[model samples]
Target: MKHTYTDAMADIETLDTRPSAVVISIGVVLFNRREPKVKMKELNLKFGKKEFRDEQIMMGRTVDKETVAWWKGQEPDAKRIFKQANVTSMEDALNKLTAFLTQGDTNYLIWGNGSDFDNTIITSLYESFGMQAPWKFWNNRCFRTFKGEHGHITRPPEFQGVKHDAVDDARQQARYLQAIYAELQKYNILSYKERQQ
Candidate 1:
């Protein structure tokens, strides 16, 4: 089996969970999930609220009232970028994420928390700029589906950060995916080499 140590997980905090949602923050972690001790590199970015979101809304992007209502009930720290952040314009954030993912000429297996949420929303943001997403569409993976199929890997690794802080959230999600993948490997249902395929 060929060894291709190319994998990444990205998480985003957005105003709405839908494809047209305005993204507030993006967190991406590069790691080898098969490794026993995960080593990660991170790319974390925040979007300027009024400057970014308002422009997107003017350009036909959307916000959901219900999602806003839900955010109101969450802990203050969960809304990480909302309080204070070194923010960038919408396009700049996307460019930074692209640069991070495409570095070293690696073909990354990009995984997002949900098949339809994180990746889809990010892709939409890229589309607004008329640019292709950094990773190939064929390389996209969904951790939500992976977890659903491996339900018995019930216990997650200890989470050590605010739930909705994008950087911390991405790191924790990567750990969870690694844990689940290790469990699958243990059963010999799929081997390390097979997973890289």
Candidate 2:
């Protein structure tokens, strides 16, 4: 609704939609992305349930006395981060996210790893609900950040390894966005001052 075809409008259309983020992490860093500027909402998700019990199983390892303590020891710092997270079922989470996206004329879904796994989960959920996800930006855009060889770069570190905890991954993915924003600034794609208005 904010966009209109006016005399001053050019042929070029800048896809200025802000992206909604969903993260999944392990013992490593967090990942996330904010919603569109018009929405003024951010969803932060973290993961901390490291030790699986009798019914918990992952990566060919079963939850038992021998493995419980070892996994528990690896989870303290991550647990602290997610102690107050907004946890929900994957389906419920997708509903909340889609609701937020539909509030704006255009929106994007961003993840550090692109749409392979993260997008798959979300789109699959959307399909299950008999709704189509708005993911054109996700399919079209590719994120890239500069790596410093000699000088310092002011970007968050890259995410490494998989922990499969949704919240943790969101935080890590958020960093990649910061880098992308920085690159946009350097090339005059966008600026904080312009975005604020």
Candidate 3:
């Protein structure tokens, strides 16, 4: 029987991860492949100035100048959330994300855009703050891999909301995955939820 999952589509905007990367924002959407509804959450955080300067302290997590320059090249709307005046501390953001992930008893398959991007970065950030990641390693999933496998499936049009905003990105990705699953069902390509009794 093919396994199905209760997915948490997650995205993060960050300054690059060379020596040290700082998270600018996070977005997550909780949904089950077998279900149609979704629940979304997001956070915008302030980077620590001291950590930004200390190379050793930021080992394996440095922000790249190129990434910063690329961000500047993005559209104004894409950069709008980062410019918001009120941003939460990393601790506060992590706390809220933790609460959101563990709110119910459901086991989430945390789907990041790539294997080493959102989830990995968030885990590293949590460890830097002396906190454990909310989800387990076994729960990590890669949206890019799924997309690659189903490249023929047409995705829904890009969402009109803020492009780089975490919450909007997560919601859009979750909806896209849901649509793909629905199409798969319609064509009888795979009975994702069926057991081979």
Candidate 4:
């Protein structure tokens, strides 16, 4: 028999930057790939005393001017999350995310939009705070590569939520991955042995 389940999947959202990046939020969905069940958690962080200012860097977080400008072109719902009231401090957010990531003892495949984007930014944030990231380096996975190889995977009809909202994005991506994996299995394109690796 072959393994039918993946350990877990995590989707993170961040403010892109040079040198270092600021993680705006993290949304993780813990699930068994064999089953259609999942548990979700999200953390929203306050990067600085105010948005897009030197205070973020003074607190050891990086911000980029171009990235700020780019955000202006995004959807309004996507932009609203950033200004939501009562966001937690970066330290508190990190701690909560760490707790969320360790809820299960099993090692999980942490899926990010790109292999180097979300996970890299989070790891950098951990280093800046002098804390160790909960997941190992090898546990990182890329959703983009999977999508590219599999072609456009669509979201389930039930998920009518805003994109760029960390939790919603994570859930949608997880569902798409599950769909893609199942489709591959149906066509016998992905063998059990290959999947186990």
Candidate number achieving the greatest lDDT relative to the actual structure: 1
Per-residue alpha-carbon lDDT of model 3 for 1-197, expressed as tens digits? Answer: 22333668888777785314777777777776655643444443433234432432444456688988998899988776555533345567778788878876767888888878888888887887788988989888888787677646876647857888777787787777777777777787865433221
Instruction: Report residue 144 deviation for candidate 3 (angstroms).
Output: 0.5
Name model 3 segments beyond 4 Å from true: 1-5, 37-60, 85-87, 191-197
Worst 10 residues of 2 by lDDT: 6-15
Candidate 2, residues 47-133, lDDT tens digits: the string is 222321111122221223433344455555543432433444434544655564455444343432432334443444355445675
Is candidate 2 or 4 superior in lDDT?
4
The model with the greatest TM-score is 1
Which residue pairs show collisions in model 1?
Answer: none
Ranking by TM-score: 1, 3, 4, 2
| Per-residue lDDT over 12-54 for candidate 4, one digit per residue giving the tens place of the 0 to 100 score | 5555654377656666766555455544444444333355324
Q: What is the lDDT of candidate 3?
A: 0.70
Q: How does model 2 fare in lDDT?
A: 0.35
Error of 4 at 65 (Å): 1.7
List, residue by residue over 1-197, the lDDT tens digit for candidate 1: 22334688889888887898977788899988778464689888877357777878877788898888887888977754675546456677778888898888678888898999888998998887777798888889998888788856657879988888888888888888888878887877775555645
What ranges in model 1 sit over 4 Å off?
A: 1-5, 191-193
| lDDT, candidates in the order shown | 0.80, 0.35, 0.70, 0.66
